[model samples]
Target: MRYHTVIAWAAAAGLLAGAAGRGYLAPLLPPDEGHGAWYASRAAGISAYLFLWLSLAGGLLMSSAWFDGLVNRARLLAAHQAFAIAGLALGLVHALVLIPDGWTDFGPADLFIPFASYYERADAALGTIALYLFAIVTFSFWFRGAIGPATWRWVHRASFVAYLAALWHGIRIGTDTGALPVAVLYLLTSSLLIGALTVRLVYVRPRRQAPARPPSRAAAEPAG
Candidate 1:
């Protein structure tokens, strides 16, 4: 019932589900002519962004004192970890699903390697880089002890960079961004993240240095 144990279980369950969906459910689902893969990729990408946003928000809340009494940090951390893992999985699905789309002509290299795809190359590269950063941040949770707390913290901070890359990628390359609802969702979530981060930074207090001890009487007298 420990947090790490819960994270491990959740990861395993996600892998199993992904495998089953790919191996069994995919063939059973009704195809949408030639655009099915494109649709699936879009949905998965959006879902991944939403989950990543949630993970970032939860982390901010966990660190800030504003929610001290109202929320439980332990549960918040568990949820944060879970969301991060889910986002990574969904991001992978988002990339992999594109391979089947004849329109995009995405191969493994195009999806995995930054700038390898000619279709909106810069934006696609941002998404690929974001995925790698996200994966590093998520997996760092398991290696906190090995890497040390300070190192882990710095690694987690990279999520902000990853988030920006994702946001840029979505805005530039996502077909759904033209829709009012999708645009609004992106705007609102990004605003929330920025606001939370601002609050956290503003409220953080610097470590107070210990007051200097008064010079000892003996040392003062012997100074001559």
Candidate 2:
């Protein structure tokens, strides 16, 4: 528990630092136009997407039977969980950083509520929805015992919906989307996720039925 808490704090600090360093916060020194927050917002948004991709990939890899021998399942699971928590932290920073961005100022409602943003309303909505879905799936771990395995499993499945929403959010609102490298990155990650899901579904074995029992000796004798 301490370890996880430490990791969480570290990730949060790193994300905030990265975002702030990139220009998400107002500049300490006077600038020509004070676009510090704008630059930071863009950088943080892209960074959040990258972390999300890592989390998604890790989750898929953890679910993959193919890695059963190649890697330690427990370690992989830990890594997967770490990636998800980190991604969520970065994602939150990505959204919150925009709040101070004077150029594209967003409030709490604009960040959390769907269709509340005057600019890119649909795109912002997608991201907001995705963030909520991610929060539900990620935090469900803590309450899994209370919710029960079946319900928790179902909630975890919502990660897929979150993934799709995030993908669309990036494509629709990402500043670097038009770049060749960024486009390829999105395409590759999406393909990998699809392939992993396909393999997991197709390669899993069907359960075998128990063999039928023979008739009792007494019944056979009675027949005779």
Candidate No. with top lDDT: 1
lDDT for 12 in candidate 1 is 57
**Candidate 1 lDDT (Cα, whole model)?**
0.84
Q: Which 10-residue window of candidate 1 scores lowest in summed lDDT?
A: 9-18
lDDT of 1 by residue, 1-224 (tens): 26785577458546754675578646644576778888788777887888888888888877876677677767667778888888888899999988777777889998999999978999999999999999999889879999999999999999999999999999999987887767998999999999999888887645669999998888789654
lDDT of each: 0.84, 0.75
Give residue 155's error in model 1 in angstroms: 1.2
Candidate 2 residue-wise lDDT, 1-224, digit = tens = 34575376547646664765447333432363677665555556666666666666767766756687789776666656666776677788788877877777689998888999887999989998988898898778879999999999899889899989998998999776887766887898889888888877777644569898888988668553
Candidate 1 regions with alpha-carbon error over 4 angstroms: 1-33, 204-224
Best of the candidates, TM-score: 1
Candidate 2 vs. true structure, TM-score = 0.77
